[model samples]
Target: MTDTDVVVIGAGLAGSTTAAILGRAGIPTALVDPHPVYPPDLRCEKLDRGQVAILQKTGLADIALAATTFDGAIRDGKAWIARFGRVIDKRPGGQYGILYDNLVNVMRSAIPPDVTNVVAKAVHIVTGDDRQQVSLSDGSTISTRLVVLANGLSVALKDQLGIERTVTSPCHSITIAFDIKPRSGRAFDFAALTYYPERASDRMAYLTLFPIGASMRANLMVYRTMDDPWLREMRHNPERALFALMPNLRRIIGDVELVGPVKIRPADLYVSQGHRQAGIALVGDAFASSCPAAGTGAGKVFTDVERLCNVHIPNWLASPGMAVNKIEQFYDDPVKREYDETSKSWAYRLRSMSIEEGISWRIQRRLRFFVGAAISAACKIGVISDGDQFVPEGWTQRLRDRT
Candidate 1:
């Protein structure tokens, strides 16, 4: 039997990062995961400036920088945004491109020497008001004061704890990723590019191309069902399907060749119910899920980790028992709630803007592009110093308010 202050299940991005922060603060934490080294998976591969700042707040910025394969800061912090086969705007870019597994491995490595690494599966968790017991597949038991569930999309443990995840939207969106390079073996014209969809019927939200090491990575998010024929065609002939959806893309980026396997992930938006229990806390996807198109996964995860680790945990530890009321405070955190709600709102908004063919939606979509083009023109003519000024006052503003 082993004992610790906190037992973190699932050593992926959320779990590993949580353990890293807690361990750095001198908390006795035990991180449990089946694999010593996380395997490659299709997840958020790009860390935008907002996410970097959030990680910086948690003091994990250096760890993230070290794992990144491509640093946009080195390229003068510029990425082109295009629509209708032409560049529409340029945004400040400190985005980092990295493989999901690579980032997880680096995070796992950063776990302090004193933090115990339990390389085994957490089969069951027994939560109590004063103590918690986590059962590992290796027939080991870990007793702790609290359990941080960061397993992400795994429901067995949650089910055992009687926590239920309500799927708000089924098959909310699909993410397609692949490597691309010009057929002429030459480099792309820009450091990074985000090309918006040409038509609503195409169901594409956007195609983002960014550097990862020596290769240019492409991530396409679409509002499509799982059994859609387009998905089948995409898996069979990704290049053809991609170009068919965005015919003008070839003219803008020049002819390109697809390399490596095309990775696809279908996301479902969900939120956990009955989670405000004693001796347990859920973070990241374990608590809820967001659409990949929203690009808010990392931000949500970072916010949860920051709030739980820096604020709630310290306060919780200072008290006697891990009661339900004490655990509820973390869930009720304003900052954390804002990020979670923003992710949900963005998911619905982006999907509607991309695929909804109603008259109002069509008009709104066109108006959105018109506004973007106008903003681009204004920035070019020095009418506005920053294009971000024209951005709306809702979720975007909330994201910028990191304080």
Candidate 2:
């Protein structure tokens, strides 16, 4: 087996990201995955406002993203002015519907060629007392000083490491997506997240649409629980349920458009955690992944690259013999702290769950409406503070400045 300093399995966000950072830091590294594409396929049709902040902070703001044009929103039956608050993005109004593949292309272009992207299908990972080895299905093998697993889903290596992959939520949902070309000088709005969150379909199904290109192209996301009767109709007759959500969408899209027969993905959350054996590190979803409400996967992985590069790798370089313990300590301490905070934040804001389940869900859901109304009221009442007038650090002044 060939020996290397580090071997990363799976070329999803986490793996590709870390490989890029490490290679830039002058570490000999190899990234392996069967797929040639850098951005792996993603079922998620949208990224929330927070995700945009993380993406821009990571120095990828120059790339293009899909967007819509609306300015205000009706949240829980009340009006609210939408504003973009991400620190890196100066785009004032809202977030973007970045195509998954396009985002990958941007990130890939940023990574250097020295960090080899070996095309191979990884089947298993062996963690030894001193190091690790990734066995591939192609009968090739390589040993490394450390192995970082960034595979996107529940992994067989989790079982080998004695980790449990469990699902907590009972009501599972799936997403169906397709694309349509737009018309004229118009493009989907980039200043707001347009959605009919409370709109209903036959037996209560709903579809979410997002803009994904320069002129006019859209990606639609439809969600339904396993037992939801609307799912059957969607699979059998897709068009009827689609036009109901956006009326002008059909006329603009025409009799047919390019791309997609519609794809479906389970909307359930998966949690996996355990002791990281000495020679291994679990990055990204290999450790835990949440439902749509806690849209932290991409941001979390970006944080992983930042941490491993800035914190973890430097320590290991200072003391090569003490590598395993350094990585494991990161998992137990700072990583877990971040997870706990993020998860608690998700738990508190799940609006659709039972009262006993989400501690502050309803209030959280209604917050957008309240904030929107307050902003409108302030604008109407001529009480706009230019950062100096409102107690020096008031939220309203800060939001206006951020926007």
Candidate 3:
């Protein structure tokens, strides 16, 4: 049996970052993962400016930025991508575009050399008053003061620990990812672009196009059932189905050909309850899964690692045994609570914005794109100065009231 101060399961972004931070602080931390090399996974393709800031706070900003780089875009007028790029370039910490697997590997590789890397699955976790015991597939055990669960959506570990998730929406949204290249074999004019859905029948929230490496990646997000005929059509004939769903994509990205298979993921919104247990804590998707459309997964996960590693854990270890009260502090953290609540609200908003057939939503949807285009036009003509506060106060809520 080996012993450590903390055992971080699931060597993903959240887990690896936590272990790295603790190890840097000279804490005895063990990171366990089934695979020595993280398998290719398709999740968040790009990180917005806000998420970059959060990673900066965790001291992993350089690691993340180096993993991948791409230009940022917003759905404004035709020139919006240019304007957005200028702003991003001027910002302290700009956005990033990296594949999910590359991002996770970069974080894992950055873990301090002192941290123990266990290449085995954590079969079971048993928590107690003074210590927690984690049984691995190799028939070895690790006794630690705290356990950080960052295994993402897999609930087997949580189930053994008697934790249940409160699913707000099952199959809340659908995401399809694939690679595309210009038909003429020429590079795209822009580094990235966001194309919004123009028709209700498309049932799409938006289509994001960005460069991952040598090839351009396309991620189309929509609010529809997996059984929907369109999904099947997309899987069978992605080239035609995708362009049909979002005709504006061709105009924005130019003529392109599919270079890979269509990858589909049905996102579900869930928050783990009954996780404030002694000797253990949950973070990332294990604690609460976010809507991919909302783009809050990285933010929430980074915040958890930041709070736990920088603030809560140090204070807890300075004293005695890991108690329920000590672990509860992480759950009740104001920043963490805010991130959780905001993620839920964004999930509801993104879904409602896409599929709600009500009159109010109809008007809001139209205005959202219209206002964005108008702002972009204004910026181009110098009607609205850069760095100025726009958007008339009370105008947004008044529109919601149908005033």
Candidate 4:
């Protein structure tokens, strides 16, 4: 058996980052994953300013810089934020566009030399008060003081350990991703653009256009079921369906052509139940899933890593054993709880704002956009200093307090 202080299973964003931080702190850590090179996958392809700040705070900002194809900070570019076909604000740089696979690979590469990389699938895990054991498919066993489960939404390992997940909302949201280019053969007027849905009846939250390398990538977030005919139309004829859904988009970006296959990802909101166990901790999607439309997925992951590595794990390691009560402290952490709750709340709020058709919902939707437009105008005319005022009401303040 290999001995280590920490064994992080599933070396994706959360696992690799945890190992990196712990390794830097001179801890005996082992990272377990089957893939030496993370394969191409569809996930959050962009990182916002708030997520970047968290990565920097955790000393993982360099990994993001290395993986990103379009570095807004270095490019010194601005993005146009618009709603109802009207430009709301020209936001400054600090965001980045990156492929999910590249980001994971970069994060895996940054693990310090001392951290052991176990290139095999974890078949089973046994958690105890003093020691946890992990069984790999390659017939190896690793005994460690604690295990951090960052394997995303995979349920096999979680099931072996008796962790249950409860589905909050099934088929919560759908995200459509593809590449686009101007048919006119001319460059777009802006570096990036975010176009909000013109009407809640459209069932779409927004369509974001940003650069990933030379390609202009579009992520259209909608509140729809998997079997919806509209999704079929998008799959069969993405360009026509997209233009039909948002005709005003042509007026802003001019004529555009879809360059590649349209990829659709349907997400369900769930939270892992019975996770407060001995010798184990959950992070990122392993604990709960977030709505892509809310743009809170990366933020939640970064927060989980930051809190676990810097605060919880350090204190846990200084003690004698990884007991159930000690592990519970991280789960009951005020900061982690707040961030998780905020993400869940925002997901439901965005769903209602996009698809709810009641009179009150319509009125509130209009008012929300009106307030956003007002804030944008206020920032333009020197009445307000912070451009983030245009964010959903109370979101900026809550993030400020937490981060």
Which consecutive 10 residues in model 3 have the weakest lDDT in total?
84-93
Q: Put down candidate 3 lDDT per residue, 230-260, tens digits, no spaces.
A: 8999989888897777655566566788887
Q: Which stretches of candidate 4 lie over 4 Å from their true place?
A: 69-76, 387-403
Worst 10 residues of 1 by lDDT: 394-403
Task: Kindly report which residue pairs in candidate 3 clash with one another.
Answer: none
Candidate 4 TM-score, C-alpha based: 0.93
Better of 1 and 3 by lDDT: 1
Residue-wise C-alpha lDDT for candidate 1, range 298-397, written one tens digit per residue? 8899999999999999999987999999999999999999989888988898888888889998888777756665654665677764534565433332
lDDT of each: 0.86, 0.54, 0.78, 0.85
**Against the true structure, what is each candidate's TM-score?**
0.93, 0.73, 0.89, 0.93
Q: What lDDT is reached at residue 359 by model 3? A: 92
Stretches of model 3 off by over 4 angstroms after superposition:
72-94, 374-403
Clashes of 2: 7
lDDT of 3: 0.78
- Steric overlap count per candidate: 0, 7, 0, 0
Q: Which lDDT tens digits does candidate 2 get at residues 15-113? A: 766776677677878888887875446544455444555545445444423232222221122212222211111112333555566555555555678
Superposed on all Cα atoms, the candidates' RMSDs to the truth, in angstroms, are 3.1, 6.9, 5.1, 3.1
